[model samples]
Target: MIEVDCPSPAKPRVSITYCTQCQWLLRAGWMAQELLSTFRDELGEVALIPGTGGIFVIQCGADTIWDRTRDGGFPDVKTLKQRVRDRLAPERDLGHIDRP
Candidate 1:
């Protein structure tokens, strides 16, 4: 029998890349803070990468969770939090976000 090792699911490392040319640091920082506070135990880390040309992207590993250009606008904190929670902890309920 060939034994194949599979890695267990660990806390996800989220990356939020925003445009430096557009001075989007404060916006990105707010998003990072929200994610950190909401997913304190579920996230490994949140990285803010500087870019140019009105770019803002959020990723979990190589998977793109949210993209500003693609999504059409900035994500609201509650919505963004739900996205992170869905990716990292699908079964974990986000109290207010999950509620109607």
Candidate 2:
């Protein structure tokens, strides 16, 4: 289950994930955060960001407003978001930081 903070029905609980790829972070008992950018992550294919702390806040609410419309059949959105969030988190947690 996803554990998060922020007690508010309107506000989303922040979810921080270590890294699924990084054995170290995963070993530390941290789960990767799922992400879905504002709209049109790129020119074509939907981009995915890393889920560490900053990516899209990134998505601590399990599924944010944008996620509600996301195609549930595809898990890539979450995976990609996590990847981007992890990399961009150092930059003051830029919300909706586009995936490279």
Candidate 3:
């Protein structure tokens, strides 16, 4: 028998950067938990990065999924899930999130 090499797909890493001075750790942690719960299989890891100046940004791999400054304010859980789903698995349906 001959053997062939096969490589596994690289799962995307999610990074949530929140302002430390602004005291957004809970918010960041909540977001991270949401992502991990939703994309347990799709994501490689979810990281919370402490930042300052009231920054709150979510990134998938190297792509910025959500920027609080640019987008204007924080995103709701549904919106956040949709953004992450779109980036990692556009073809995957997010149940009720996809509706309405």
Candidate 4:
């Protein structure tokens, strides 16, 4: 019998903080949905946090994965997924996203 290691239903939570003043709720919601759908098995929860001053940050626990204020740009879906995958399942392959 071949055994495979499947992702557990419970894992670290992810939070996305977006600027309410900047009207980034839709963008943040879209990213949250993408992350949740992609890593449904590996992730426990995805939270959307509203803020001000053009803040757009994505965090897994205390670690900051992406910050628009620091990175000077918003993260694309593939890039965000890759970062999440790196922390959650480093050994897993990301297929097309890994392609050059």
Candidate 5:
């Protein structure tokens, strides 16, 4: 659930791209909080104004794996949708990926 109070408005919606190197990159189930830590205030103008709904997105090793159910913490609907999409991604277009 989003916080009840925000320092400002303008909520930040995020989309994460795993580098295939971040060992932690595994599934969308745990992406939201991960994004909050990774993207943090770096969004600049799109900065999440400490609001009820800010910061979202995540993925796993393939840049698609979606599984926002952490056994305990469940991300919001928007976060879940993105994860599902990444999970259902096309397998052939992955030609751009390279080993780090």
Candidate 6:
């Protein structure tokens, strides 16, 4: 008899890469917290990656959801939540955040 390993399906993961030199750890951590809180049941994990050269990027799986330089600076909490929700759970409602 041969033994085989089978892996279960994994939930979505979010990664926030921030610049260590720029002191963005707190900011990255806060964003991770927000995502976790909002998507408690939907997400697998939230990772904080340290980088330099003023990088602040938020990625969901293999897709880059937000790039500080490309998106023009940090996103407000509301916007960040919306973007994340869109990727993780498009049909889910964000209450006040969904209101214009």
Best candidate, lDDT-wise? 6
Which is better, 2 or 3, measured by lDDT? 3
Best of the candidates, TM-score: 6
Worst 10 residues of 6 by lDDT: 4-13
For model 5, what is the C-alpha lDDT against the true structure? 0.36
Error of 6 at 74 (Å): 0.3
RMSD, candidate 6, Å: 5.0
Kindly list the per-residue Cα lDDT of model 4 for residues 4-98, writing each as its tens digit.
65544568889999999999999999999998888888898888999999899999988899999788799999999999999999988888988
Expressed as tens digits, the lDDT of each residue in 1-100 for candidate 3 is 9995442348878899999999999999999999999999998888899999999999988899899999999999999999999888889999988899
Model 6 has an lDDT value of 0.91
Worst 10 contiguous positions by lDDT, candidate 5: 43-52
Give the per-residue Cα lDDT of candidate 1 at 53. 86
Report the alpha-carbon TM-score of model 6 versus the true structure: 0.89
Off by over 4 Å in 1: 1-9
| Candidate 4 collision pairs | none
Collision count of model 5? 4
| Candidate 2 structure quality by residue, lDDT tens digits, 1-100 | 9985544354333443323343234322222322323222321222234444222222434534223124342234545444444443434344454435
Ranking of predictions according to lDDT: 6, 3, 4, 1, 5, 2
The order of the candidates by TM-score, greatest first, is 6, 3, 4, 1, 5, 2
What is the per-residue lDDT of model 1 for residues 1-100, given as tens digits with 9 covering 90 to 100? 9996443357678999999999999999999998989888988888899999889999988888899978889988888988888788889988878898
TM-score of each: 0.86, 0.20, 0.88, 0.87, 0.24, 0.89
Clashes of each: 0, 15, 0, 0, 4, 0
| RMSD score of candidate 5 (Å) | 13.1
Cα lDDT, all candidates:
0.87, 0.35, 0.91, 0.90, 0.36, 0.91
Identify the runs in model 2 with alpha carbons over 4 angstroms from their true place: 1-58, 61-69, 82-100
Clashing residue pairs, candidate 3? none
Predict model 3's lDDT versus the native: 0.91
